[model samples]
Target: MERNLELTIRMDNDHVEIDVYEPESGECSQIDAPLSFDEHPEFDAAVGNEIYSWLSLWADELAGQN
Candidate 1:
């Protein structure tokens, strides 16, 4: 079986929100926090790494179930 995963990122002046959706199972996960862009130049890369880690862990758990 194949699993479908979707990721969405939304940012505003005060914070950044990251949402993960598994459409096949209607499971959703999110990560959000206050961000100061001027203070942290590595914000984008850091957040990207976090999301990738979440996806990898989710995938591994799903694979183990099968």
Candidate 2:
């Protein structure tokens, strides 16, 4: 099934921002307000199943937080 969700991300020297969009029925709703990531932690590695596992957990946590 096709998800109605879309993610847009932007980053600069100062901060990072994420926007989630939902489009349906000739209308679009910005489901999530843009979030700033100024205090985000650093990740040294990005490879393999570990990344997938982390993302899955992160997604769940983020959902709950929101």
Candidate 3:
């Protein structure tokens, strides 16, 4: 089956944020927002195995840190 997901990554001066959205059910929740690559390498490893792995593919573009 094919599915669509809305993933958001936000960063403030001192905060890093990540939100996951499920359009089918209109449900949303906070996952994890690792501030820097060095801050949360674990989040990176965990997300790599997820369906939203594509989110990481665009991390540079979205995070504006690359």
TM-score winner: 3
The most accurate candidate by lDDT is 1
* Pick by TM-score: 2 or 3, better one: 3
TM-score of each: 0.47, 0.32, 0.53
**Model 2 spans > 4 angstroms off:** 25-66
Question: How do the residues 1-66 of candidate 1 rate in per-residue lDDT, one tens digit apiece?
Answer: 445668898999888887878786687777676777567656666668766876787789888999
lDDT of each: 0.74, 0.43, 0.64
Question: How many clashing pairs does model 1 include?
Answer: 0
Query: Which regions of candidate 3 are displaced past 4 Å?
Result: 45-66
Give the clash total for candidate 3: 0
The candidate, 1 or 3, that scores higher on TM-score is 3
Give the least accurate 10-residue stretch of model 1, judged by summed lDDT. Answer: 37-46
Clashing pairs in 2: none
Listed per model in order, the count of residue pairs whose N, CA or C atoms clash below 3 Å is: 0, 0, 0
Residues 1-66 of candidate 2 have per-residue lDDT tens digits of: 233545566666654444444444233222222233543223222123334554575578678977
